[model samples]
Target chain A: MSNQSLVDAEWALSHLDDAKVVFIEVDEDTEAYAGNHIKNAIALNWKTDLQDPIRRDFVNKEQFEALLSAKGVSNDDTVVLYGGNNNWFAAYAFWYFKLYGHSDVRLLDGGRKKWELDGRELVSDVPSRAATKYVAKDQDLSIRSFREDVLKAIGTQNLVDVRSPDEYAGRLLAPAHLPQEAARIGGHIPTAANIPWSKAANEDGSFKSIDELKALYEGAGVDLNKDTIAYCRIGERSAHSWFVLHELLGVKNVSNYDGSWTEYGSLVGVPVAVGDEPGTA
Target chain B: MSGCGAVVGGVSLDNVDITNQAVIQGVISSGNAPASVGYARLLDRNDEFVAEVPISKQGEFRFFTVAGDWTIVALIPGANSRTPVQATIGKILDVDIAVIK
Candidate 1:
């Protein structure tokens, strides 16, 4: 069950020309793939292609179907996703694929970072596949959570704020590079554990060993047995954590709060806890 | 909704005016060549990760942060290095990191 959702560079390299497999790159720097990418890989902009144009939510089922169809991704193809920033956006897309009930989807371990670091060949040639009549299922809501679920889980479930410590402590509203006006207030949900998503990744951008991952969360006071919800300012980073907890560790009940702090912190009358401590109820 | 993080990979700030911003910017290189494929990470005083961005094709990276002591770590193929700098408001600090393979 553990290695079922991940593939290494070697496996991916050997299958570069496999007709039954598709490689998709979803990068944080949206432009990364354009510079160079794995042979025959297609690019999916996490913002434009995946998200709904007017709504704050993801694309509807029909839209997803059209997207994959245009990308020539068949329902039976094995989709392997990779990206920059330790596969942050890639994992987010992986969650989206799972939400739409796509089977046989997996992540490229370490993603673009590892691919480049290993001195692997990345070609600028883009390949085109004939469009397929893609079909998508209703969103699997079990893996996704809304602000209400977050509020309800407060002090009851294992709520994990997978942002930088500064963000969790209210020292900064958002990451240092981005604008600081994402939320009306700054701080994390009460009784939430602050475990930055970067902890699950190595300096080289690959995920740590399974034993290391288990110890990292358990050492951070995240009860593995409890139903857990992971959140970041937006959802991508938390999706990485959700992948770790749910897919990698085989946790029975884990969800990613896509609305995250922007929705939760902006909600009026809801309690917000500042400082380094995970405040009590 | 607005995007959450900056667009990375071969980004150029040549036209960006950082006149009044506290910025930590640099070019990453190994030996005599630019380390074009990699990521640059900004770490706080406590050595905790703050943010990361993919380096430009020209091996450039930048971070707009509060004026303070910070460390910049470059993760590239066959090489990695960290450099410390003290940033000040209204001024740009350039710290070029040379990774040894």
Candidate 2:
């Protein structure tokens, strides 16, 4: 039940004054941090800070380095990320941190939802820190997957589509709240397991125990022993699952396909399986 | 990056175009004033988690759903509430949730 990749509210509260720990909030709603946040925590807009303005990919390593440097994060600082919507974008940022080879990154368990539900203190005051010269390593391709990788892993690896059942079943192209026209078609990648990412989380927005997570994935026929790639509409949700498998469960070979269904379901002549079942490869 | 960007919800109904869409939208309030902070979660008919969006400073939340029975759960600090809603296409359903501390 111990995970080095996560810290609870108690741990976060105790570390509020820790010079070596940096609390970063990455919310799906970028404005959440402005209204109120955990004291001394800074905000990283998942939309602007993490994404490339022109391309569909993330910001380059230099951008990432400059971002951390501006945020006063040193190479040795332990970065703890948390956000709203069960830390969906926080996990995305965590995966991005890992992709850039940052060694001491962790997620704040339950994120803003759990913190607010617990009646924890949140403040609107922002903190300022001296800028540091931050360095980022090259992208770690091992923890990331491309469209070709997903196509090749159809029958060989465990492809877990972490969208809701309706999305997986081709009934909805995107989440209910989002515009439904992101992809040209609905349905899931062929042979992908339809294990919704929400299953790994609790009602209070905290992640489930390791045993429960393992059981949930295994019950969905996801083979943990095999190389795994998790995807959602745009990869944020799958990053939550990626955090669970690779960080919490200690799975060695897991990747988050950032392009996800937005790329896969829209590609010309790519295999897409419709209906409730996981279609054949 | 069509669906890749963040969807900032909690917008006033005036900003949303509900044309040809089945919408479940609302505002969160406590003591007759807009709740400043909270999240509105959408649950399917079976009570399974569907999606979640942060409430705006104005305490607004909107969901573009298909015609069906759904439950909206408001998670506000020190207070929480849920309301069942039935949505039909080409119509907008407004359900205000009142939470108390």
Candidate topping TM-score: 1
For model 1, how does the per-residue alpha-carbon lDDT over A144-250 read when each residue is reduced to its tens digit? 99988988889899999999998899877767665344236889999999999989988877888999999999899788888899999889999999999988988
Q: iRMS for model 2?
A: 2.7
- Where in model 1 is the C-alpha error above 4 Å? A179-183, B9-21
For candidate 2, lDDT tens digit of each residue in A17-117? 89899999997565678878999999998878888998899999999999999999999999999988788989999999999999899999999889987
**Candidate 2's error at A224, in angstroms?**
1.1
Model 1 clash pairs?
B10-B56, B10-B57
- Top DockQ model: 1
TM-score of each candidate structure, all chains considered together: 0.94, 0.93
Return the lDDT, model 1, position B42: 87
Candidate 2 ranges beyond 4 A from true positions: B2-17, B30-34, B99-101
> What DockQ class does candidate 2 belong to?
acceptable
Listed in order, the DockQ scores are: 0.52, 0.48
Chain A only: TM-score of every candidate? 0.97, 0.98
For model 1, the DockQ equals: 0.52
